[model samples]
Target: MERIAIAVFITGASGLIAQVVLLRELLTIFQGNELSVGIILSNWLILEAVGSYIGGKGVEKIRKRVEFFYSFSLFFSLSLVAGIYAVRLGRLLLKSLPGEGVGIGGMLLLSFLV
Candidate 1:
C-alpha cells in the first residue's frame, strides 16, 4: 500500500538520478567521446538487464522482508553517492597510471561500479 508506493517512488527517483550521474561521470572521464558514450550505455543496459534478472530470482525469498528492501534501498542510495565521488576523484587518484585518462577497460570497470 502506502509503504510500497513510497518504496517504488524512491526507487524510481534514485535510479534516474544514478543514471544521470553515471552518464555525466562517464562523459567527463571519457572526454565526451561518442564511442565511449555508446560503449558505456550499451554495457549499462546489458548489466541492468542482468541485475534485474538476478533480483527477480531472489524476490520470492525476500518477499516477507520489507525491512530488507528498505535497507537495500538505503544502501543503494549511499553507494550511488560514494560511486559518484569515486568517479569524480578517479583522475587524481589514478594520475600516476600513465595515461591522458583511464583506458576502455578502466572506464568499463568504473561504469560497472557505478
Candidate 2:
C-alpha cells in the first residue's frame, strides 16, 4: 500500500497546487470584494469535502488489481481533469454575468462534481 499512498499523495498535492494558484489569482483580481470572494472560496471547500466523501466510498466499490496504485492514479487524473475543465468553463460563464450568481452556479456544479 505504500505505492498507493505515494501516488495519491502526489496527485492530491498537484491538485492542491492548481486549485491554490487559480484561487489566488482570483483573489488578486477581486481584492476589494469580501463577500463575493467568500462565496467563491466556500464553494471550493465545500465541494472538495463532498468530492472526498463521495470519492472515498466510490473508490472502495471499484475493485482493482491487488496493486491498487493504478486506481489511485486514474482517480487522481480524472478528478484533476474535471476540476480544471469546470473551472475554465465556469470562468467564462461567470465573466459575462451581472453579479455573484454565476459564481454560485459554479459552486453548485462543483458540489455535484464532488
Candidate 3:
C-alpha cells in the first residue's frame, strides 16, 4: 500500500522530469521555435496514451508482477536516456546547421520517431 503509493509517486515524478528534459533537448534540435513546443507536447501526449493503453492490456498477462514492475521501471529510465541521445543525433542526421530551425516535416518525423 504505502510502498506502492511511493513507487507511483516516484514514477510520475520521473516521467514528468523526463518530459521536461526531452522538451529541452527537442527545442535545441528544432531551434527553439514555438511550434516545436506544441508539436513535441502533442506527440508526447498521444504516444503516452497509446503506450498506456497497450501496457494496460498486456500487464494482466504477466505472472511475476513485482519483477515485471521493476524491469519496466528500469527500461523506462534507459529509454529516456536513449530518447535524448536520439534527439541530439537527429540534428546531425537531418543535415541541419547549428541553430538552424528544422522544418515542420522534419520536426514531426523526428518527434514521432524519437
Candidate 4:
C-alpha cells in the first residue's frame, strides 16, 4: 500500500511538473492567458478529487476482506521490485546522458508493474 502511494505521488509529481511547463507554453500556442491556466489547474484538481474518492471507495471493500499479512507481503514484494527496477533504469538512463526515451516511461511502467 505504501508502494502504491509512493508510486502515485512520484508519478503524479512527475506529470505535474511536465504539465506546468506545457501549460505555460499554451499562452503562446493558443493566445491564452492566466485565466486559461487557472481553469486548467482547476480542472486538474477537480478530476483528481473524483479519482481519489473513487479509489478510496474501491479499496475500502478490498481492505476489509484481504488479510493484512498477505496483502502487505504482496505489497512489500512489489515495492522491492519497483524500487530495484527504478534505481537500475534511472542509473542506466543517466549514464546515457540526456538521450533515449527512458524518461517517464520507466517510472510509469513500474507503477503498472507493481
Give me the candidate number with maximum lDDT: 3
Q: In candidate 2, which residue pairs get closer than 3 Å at backbone N, Cα or C atoms, i.e. clash?
A: none
Write the residue-wise lDDT of candidate 4 on 16-96 in tens digits. 664555444332322354554455566557677987899678776674543654565566556555644554454354343
Give lDDT: candidate 2, residue 37.
66
Which scores better on TM-score, 3 or 4? 3
In candidate 1, what are the lDDT values of residues 2-113, reduced to their tens digit?
9799878989998898989878976887777877788789888999899899988988887557888779888888988898898887766556243376677777766776
Error of 4 at 1 (Å): 10
* Order by lDDT, highest first: 3, 1, 2, 4
The per-candidate count of clashes, in order, stands at: 0, 0, 0, 0
lDDT per residue (tens digit) for residues 1-114 in model 3: 999899989999998999889888889888887899989888888998999999899988999998987998999999998999999899888889986778998999899988
Q: lDDT of each structure? A: 0.79, 0.60, 0.90, 0.50
Query: Model 2, stretches more than 4 Å misplaced?
Result: 28-32, 65-92, 95-114
Please state every model's RMSD to the true fold in angstroms. 2.6, 4.6, 1.1, 11.6
Greater-TM-score candidate between 2 and 3:
3
Better of 1 and 2 by TM-score: 1
**58: Cα error in model 3, Å:** 1.4
* lDDT at position 89, candidate 3: 94
Off by over 4 Å in 1: 92-102
Of 1 and 3, which scores higher on TM-score?
3
The candidate with the higher TM-score, 2 or 4, is 2
